[model samples]
Target: MTLLQDPANKNRYKVNLVPAANGLNVRTQIPFYSPWRVFFFADNAADLAETMLLYNLNEPCKIENTEWIKPVNYVGIWWEMHLGISTWAMTERHGATTENMKAYIDFAANHGIDAVLAEGWNKGWENWGEKDAFSFTEAYPDFKLKELAEYADEKGVMIIGHHETGGDIELYERQLDSAFALYQSLGIHHVKTGYAGPTPDGEHKHGQFMVNHYNLVMQKAAEYEISLDVHEPVMFSGLCRTYPNLMTGEGVRGMEWNAWSEGNMPSHTCIIPFTRGMAGPIDYTPGIFDIDLSAHKEDREKWNSEDRGNTAVHATLANQLALMVVLYSPMQMAADLIENYEGHEAFSFIENMPATWDESIYLDAEIGEYIVVARRSGTTWYVAAITNEEKRDIAFIANFLNEGKTYIARMLYDSPESHYENNPEDYQILETEAQQLDGFNLKLAPGGGAIIVFEPD
Candidate 1:
């Protein structure tokens, strides 16, 4: 769906449907009606962030039993491949071996993380970008799916099943039921579906064909009481509120881009809460302790030909930490390697952070510049703020705190020397006491961010 500006009228804009091989072909009965062209209005960015108009517009929950649908805070073996330390294909340096997944599962069980996602556990990753190259129900020899699932269950952690279709919709559709049934038999409740390559029939990723395909998969997943985190998916249209099992999706340029290309700018995340965030929850995959690729530099050069040796995350360490609160995803990922997080002081924040929230408040925002948000879970409140490339001082009153109640605020923010390019890892943690109406001031470095967790004192 392309937004085109009017050539004749300077102030007018229109939505255009780009034609693909399938074109805009839809045959319906005589009484058919087109979908709604929604337009939302708000007095300010904060008002826009809090609006539930989209959820209201969507249908009510269709499933009778909603208790099975729950939020997932997961760790994964995904980042290593993106960082060039490992390969997705079944090579000597493959990332998704049984031993590696078991280690991740053990880490999740110990760290309060809910599940573990193993992306390359299945076969056909070697033939990525080719049609009909992947089998949803098959696994590589190195990855023993049944054994890993049993180990994860014993550790009290769940395995997030992966089904990368290589954009072969027909192949996925044929094996969809059998694949879901396999996962169900293994007691796996969540799956992350990927469509990394072009559709075989040349349908646009956002075209009607893919849209209907996604809907069909979601409906089938619901039948088996499974949740999904979809990547390369259609823009969310508030169907999550209805299906609920459509937990979160990746419709934005996520953290993986930092590993491969010139990373997302500081302003990119600042703009998301008001734009892409309005659609629904996002799988932005936050919490990277290693701001620069220092640990993997040598290994990356040895293993990955695609590594240009220049790509690194363009945000302060605090900026990555703050994203857990600023960006919402029910299936949130601590998207760094386990070794990067082990024995790290900053890891405490992610270890204790909650993926599901009871309430969220937009404190302040200026689109593409900066944003501040506060979310509450049970009695604790977590506030996160992020800035663009320019350093600035942000001050706000904590009137949202419970009246007359003393609380402890644990703040993690960029240090005075912190810069995204020069010293992205420089940050400081502070603890202070606060109450209702207390004024707080924060100095954010260029391409930096801050996170504050408030607990009852």
Candidate 2:
């Protein structure tokens, strides 16, 4: 096993002290024993805020700290729109065979992705109207769980499995052994469990059934050495510190809402950083680099066929790449289709993101309008600065980089010379070196953004 340690061998990645008006933003960091290199953050010396200590891989990667801090750190992507369809469904769209799953896997592997989360691959959603959600084992008969696991393993990719129990806590508890057996037998490590809708007869489960269920799963998962990615049930309360495998959970209407409902307005993405995201870690998989706003397909209707106008493609790409630092999901999702990334230069920005961070800093921001965030995974650093519907020509201070430490900055932002409007895939990528207090004036179009990565000189 490759154990991580700082130059002093303290196993600590960073320790910083930033003075604020109310108090100091004191952050100390350390490494976790897992695929993603994670470093938790806190306000009061690691006591008030929780810290995630990873032992084995049972739960998804987690945002160990997000307490007054609106923007946290994460970099990941999702495979399905919701718990609605399997990769096979995409093949079915073209009358292709399920074997195409390999192609999807290859696409993800070729990209610099941390993990691939396949939703709706379970067996409960079909009978959701009957309160019988989904099941992973029975839904995709062609899904040889073992082979899928091996295939992902061979490709150096991790699988984030989904298990939608449909709030049948009693049944899930009863069949715990069988469920555990299936995952264990298949060498699966991470699971995205779901619980939507009201409890039976108003009896209810736990006051924090969502949180409690996650805790319960963590206990069981620890026994089997697995990780968890929960959805729709609990609010994040920093259990991730106690249960490192608990990567992230969902509690808001994500990109899927855009496909199906008019309520999920284009502005909704900018709204989350302050509202639902404030509670803690949200699996609000952001990075939909493609805002076709005009593409049509059979699944489009299934998603409710809402109008998503051209919101500046570059803005979307900027947000997706910036999400690595702006949003917080250790096991975060890229949340876009494979074809959407094809031939897009900014896709390289996505492929280069590190899911876990050794250090992070919430540079600056105004809730709902815009935010700037910076995160570091070792010698490497990433920064994302984004704005809402308005266009911006803002200046950025390279204060986060080490002084005297020469570094290369790869940046993608809007330019006046380009004919494309908010076209993220078409934006010019530039490399520059920073050795002192340097600055860059980024001009973003309406619904546009800027994404930059820095590596040690």
Candidate 3:
């Protein structure tokens, strides 16, 4: 789908669907039907965030007994590769070796995280981006898939499987059942699938061909009771309601962009909840303790030409922490090296944060400027607020807290000396007693944010 603005009329626009030309575009015999074109109306960002039009438009749950469909907080051998501290392809610094996987699994288990994702455990990174170069069911020489899976299970953690098809849908389609069966047999219920390159038939990711393919994969995954977290995927349109196993997707500009490029503007996250977030859950993979790639500079220069050394997370450390609450994803990733998180005081927030929420409230928002949201799991309430590049002051009202109950609010916010560009790591943690309807004012540094966890006192 392409949107073109009129040259003569500034206010006019045109929407066009590019032809697939692949004969499979549309081949209905009787009265053909098109997918629903949706338009949403909202009086405020809160309303926008709370809208369920997309889910309501889709069909009801098709998979009965969704007992296996569960939310997970995961750590992975993913971000290290992006930082150039390790390589995806097997090498001296290969990130997905059995030892690395076991270490990550141990970290997740110790931290109360639910799962560990091993991206390079499978054979294919050596030929990444090449069609048919990946064997989804085959393990790399250094990665003992079955052994690691068993170890994770022993440690009370699940392995989030990875399948990088390099955008060769044909190859992935052929191996879908076998690949899913392999994980299912090993008791791995969650899978993160990637399509990083061009499709075999020049198909657009959002085009009909890929849309059908995505749906097919989702349905097939259900056969093996494997949930999916798809990257380089088509925009989510509330399919999770019908297929609850369609856990989360990476259709928006996500964290990895920060590693190799100028990274997302501070406002990028501030605006997502009102836009991309309304569609469904997003796997934004938050929680980066290392704001700048200072520690990995030499390694990045040697391993990844894409890392020019000028790029960083482009937000304060507190902003990364706050995103765990701001962004909604059932399968959330604590996306940093285990070494970075080890013994870090702020890492406590990520460790205690819940991936599944019982309820949510969009407290306040201004599109692309700032947003404040609160979510509740059991009796605890987690609130997150983020801003654009400009520093601003905001107030948090505890009216959402349980009535007549006293609570303790632990706030992690950007320090007065903090700035996204200069001192991104400076942050302060404060704890205070709070009563229902109580309020407090916070100072958010430029490109910064805050997270407050309220527990009943």
Candidate 4:
């Protein structure tokens, strides 16, 4: 018998979804305008339960045709600081060359990455305080813009255009036409724009100014059929459902500033699940394989007189991996350098990570103390459980799996023998055949974590 399952809400209205050729044919008796939230995941997993809880409001909003809606499956590969594609490159460690740029693009293609966020490749902020930044339509003389876009398109890689303004609203508005024209010429479908500056009139731009601008761009992009990934903007307000093209927005601090500043710690990421992030989807780009906390310490010491505290916690890397499941972003970014993942086994999880989930669950979490998140893409389930600076041993019941099916679970975590100096090969991988009755115990170190990938045998 063909099996079908609908969202189970024993006490209230439920959405009945029938499997269709493309997706789920959804049907719900609830009113169309009923205040509701629909969580999207790539598959079925334990995490889906949590997602339903976090977004499920008091109102009655029913699913119309589940079969019509499919999970989003696009992973965003951020190629700005990591890959030297534009002059706005932050680290200056990498160079901007066609070969180097293509390497990252190829990395994405090889690793099953679906989308590429070419940040800092647009016009503006080329010279931190020196000259104008490079434009997409214009060639860099070293690399041809059109060629790069064509190459990416040919390789089945969707290029996500980026626009970062250092708080220059006038510049953005004035050059809006040219900006759109540039992306259009290059066949870019999605754009990730950001504004980093002092709030106008002493109010946060992300609150009002940036939010208004975000909607404006969304409106304009809708006319052009372009998608949006806003950064340093307003918190999510269920705009994805309304403007399906507005994939995600980044308001919280992400991994980038973490490398230089001390903003994003395990505690900070943990706090987001219930605070600022509670409102909507956060492009709080996760996934940092390399926790080189000692990096730039000399510079920090010589240039400034503050302790450049080490951030490469034993568990933070695992926490990042777990974030792939915890956070809901259509344009998700694995915010780490490619070389950091080279030859590492855990990188497999990062490579296979899906942009959206078919179902997601917040799991157990206590704001800033710790969090457990699970997400499903298909029949397979990916779980990421993480704690803050404090370490703890936890267990997750595998009741979300198919009851009778034998499933294999692969695990990765920080090894007891590994430290900051010898952390490269500290990961241990284990496999176990489990049923719904099995519960997995994970011993995570201080600032450490555990990652599990489950598949039916």
TM-score of each candidate structure, all chains considered together = 0.97, 0.74, 0.96, 0.76
Tens digit per residue, CA lDDT, model 2, 40-79: 4544321212233323323544434323111122222233
Q: How high is the lDDT of residue 141 in model 2?
A: 51
- Rank by lDDT, highest first: 1, 3, 4, 2
User: What is the C-alpha lDDT profile of model 1 across 81-123, one tens digit per residue?
Assistant: 8887888899989999988998999899989899999988888
Question: Which portions of model 3 miss their true places by more than 4 Å?
Answer: 1-15, 23-25, 302-305
Q: Residue 198: error of model 2 in Å?
A: 3.1
Cα RMSD (angstroms) for every candidate in the order listed:
1.6, 12.2, 1.7, 11.0
CA-lDDT, candidates in order: 0.89, 0.58, 0.88, 0.61
**Distance from true location, Cα of 77 in model 4, Å:** 8.4
Off by over 4 Å in 1: 18-22, 302-307
Question: Model 3 lDDT vs. the true structure?
Answer: 0.88
Candidate 4 backbone overlaps, count: 32
lDDT of 4: 0.61
Candidate closer to the true structure by lDDT (higher is better), 1 or 4: 1
Clashes of each: 0, 27, 0, 32
Give the Cα-based TM-score of candidate 2 against the true structure.
Answer: 0.74
